[model samples]
Target chain A: MIEEVFAVGTSRIHRVDPRHRVVFAAVFSVQTAIGKEPAALILALAAALVLVLAARLDARRVLQRSVPVLAFLMLLWLVLPWTVPGRPWLTTGPLSASMEGVRLSWQISLKSISILLALMALTATMTAATLGHALHHLGVPEKIVSLLMITYRYLFVIEAEFTRLWRAAKVRGFRPRTNLHSYRTYAYLVGMLFVRASDRAERVYAAMRCRGFKGKFYTLAVFPAGRDTVWFSLGMSGLAIAMAAAEWTATV
Target chain B: MDRTDPIIELKGVSFAYPGGPQVIRHLDFALHKRDRIGLVAPNGSGKTTLLHLILGLLKPSEGEVRLFGRSMRGEKDFVLLRTKIGLLFQDADDQLFNPTVIEDVAFGPLNTGKTREEALAISRDTLHRLGLSGFEDRITHKLSGGEKQMVAMATIVALQPEALLLDEPTVGLDEKTHKRLIALLAELALPCVIISHAFDFLSATTDRILTMENGRIVLDEEMRVHIHEHAHKLGSKPHRHV
Candidate 1:
């Protein structure tokens, strides 16, 4: 559940200031993404997994949430090995699994899981509100921060609206089929959802204006840098640099 | 029945959507200080539109909207005027757009140039007033319908508006929440122009009832408690109830 994903708890990782978490996660994610050597990627993955454990996050839940991403990686693994033309690792009739392609797929899969785990551990422990405040304090534009805030807040609402429309369709004997009528109906439903959402946006703006909103968003929460904040950033940055060193050594 | 100078007034008001039929036609109304006015109208009536016009959210084709003794003509004027009159939307989801409840409630105070601590204090007090203490960090979208409604109201009252313009404030509330809302609203000492379809709620909350039909005020009278007597179809005896 979304609520469960964002539930606040007292853990060391959770106590790490949101600004530090955001910056470290972003920098580490970029490092992991650019990494090519399996040794360094493995180290990165291990570091992320250890963070998850230290955070006391539910590993099973994180895996469950990662199912869709893992599934997409599986698709890449299936297609890449047979499609890329290189020194074949295995051959079956006309299909050849290339060693280079397999290695590339492994790299992508490891990077994705490492970054995903890092994000869940470092960032998802805090509420989105905290993240927005962190982003604002990190010098992100107020407009962008507010946009993110509103989008995060209204996502569930729009999803509920979609579900309501879907249920209404279901009760009216609407059935999905491989037919033009079904496709048209689905298109119309999406169009209607957009229309309703736009109308809601207008009303929301009016509501904001009614409360003296003059094209600016203000949040009361402030994430001031404390001792823990500095220590957390230094620790995370050191780990990131170590990973980068590992990548360079492995390539050399 | 206490009345004073008009807090809200509309003169020769007529409104029409672009390339559409007129929604409001030649409507004139005034809400005085200490007046609790309930506007009851059927769906498709111009009740919400009328409220928007008063707030300067919508412009009437040919009319003047005077709020707190000043004619609202432009964006700058409306911007200043809006701080004095809070408008509660029909859907709480539309109103509570901040990531957290407290931030949403504090948005107005912050925009009005209050310090962060001051805004937080105001938000906490307002939420406490609405019986929502400790909901400061509650995710706005994840709240229950009733909680969202209360939080939305808290957002408005945090600004300390002199008047309220409510559009179906109790639309999707459960009975318990509805009663709580009525209680909270009853405690407010500000003028209000409430648009609602719930006749019973209107009867209980407002001092005057105005019924709108076809873009015009069809009825305006002092609200009085009236008992409805109805018999079950299978029973012969009439049951009296208020």
Candidate 2:
């Protein structure tokens, strides 16, 4: 059901609450960056992989999203271990790059992956409205939250208008064949969209005001957070417990 | 009749768009209390524009549009005017913008600074009247057109506006929905002016039928005594006879 809201496939990942995934992602990034340690960093990667499997999300789909960071990580692994100088394990040439930089870049890659994975996992499992309600109850500023809500609400309307304009243009044989012409076409398209949107905004504002819209947007009462709240709390504490266990293991 | 004069009396009113053609030229009409009038005209014959003029949405170019005996001027006039006259647009999609159906109905009262509880109560009361007592949480856009139109009427009635103006309220409704709406309108005793094209529906429902030709009222006659008795025997519909 949550998967339907977020437009994600009905996987185990979608079954977990959105807010829990967010908190878990936050803790994973923070605890993994405690020291320049590869083992802890690999542990973070292993956790992300395990989450992917549990969620039943296709591995290729997940890796496709991580392509850019993965390429960067592979490059850093080659150059950093060869360059950064500390105690020279395999003395290369006279370049004398630091081994600490090598370790640091490795940690950076893992940290980036952990954060990215967590965010994608969370977003794919929640609707923008649920995230907004979460923000609204968590003491976030009203203006920002309402603005984002309105933006999300009206995006479909604006896009529908654009689609109409595009269909009309296509009928008139508008084709891009050169860079300059393409740029000009894009500029014209944006300009027309802005003017149309402004006119629509004026009429919509007038109609709304006539209906007695003061300033603030209001909604019917929200549902109780309930069991989802308990799950989020448990997930955060679970992450903390895992981090403590990692520290104890490292010391031993 | 409570020993009072006509609720809305407009004597020899004339209006035109600024630097444009006359949309309501030399219009003369008087609406007494509980007058259920239907104004019918062909497309581009200034039906909706005339309703706008009556609601004090647009000022007369030359003559008077007195609402309850006071002359309307500007913002204050409009504000006072809106409190008395409510307009239901042809497109209910334009009227209802709130996410939930209940919130959409509550907008009018809340905008007037009613307490949240008061707004909720008014919305509930209006819904109950409209036979939608349990549909408070449905999304506005998801409603069918007939449902949307009924909700729009519900929102206006919540304000308890004395005069209600509905522009083409049943253009595309099914026959069953249309008959049901006519019954609902007949039950509500507010002074209403329904702008529509269905003459038989208008003849069946309205107390008086008014015709507009070239932005002017060409004919006004009582439904039972004048139009059906005399006009039906003499010739044809309002457009043919007038």
lDDT of 2 by residue, A94-209 (tens): 65556576667767887888766766665555555555655665557877877775566556556767888878877889887778976887788889999977856655555565
Overall local distance difference test of candidate 2: 0.69
Alpha-carbon lDDT, every model: 0.85, 0.69
The reply for model 2, stretches above 4 Å from the true place, is: A1-4, A7-146, A164-196, A223-225, A237-252, B1-22, B25-30, B53-70, B80-84, B128-135, B220-242
Give per-residue CA lDDT, model 1, range B1-242, as digits (tens).
12455888899899998998899999998888878988876787889889898888998899888887888787778888887888898889889888878889989999999999999899899998888999998778879888888888899899899899888888667777778788888898688988877777877788887888778876655545465755567556432121
lDDT of 2 by residue, B181-231 (tens): 777777777887888777767765777778787667766554332445443
Which segments of candidate 1 are over 4 A away from where they belong? A1-7, A79-99, A224-231, A249-252, B1-5, B174-176, B221-224, B227-242
DockQ of each: 0.80, 0.27
The ten-residue window of minimal lDDT in model 2 chain B covers B233-242
Clashes of each: 0, 7
In model 2, pairs of residues that clash are A83-A97, A84-A97, A84-A98, A84-A99, A85-A97, A85-A98, A85-A99
| Candidate 1 C-alpha error for residue A2, in Å | 4.4
Model 2 has a DockQ score of 0.27
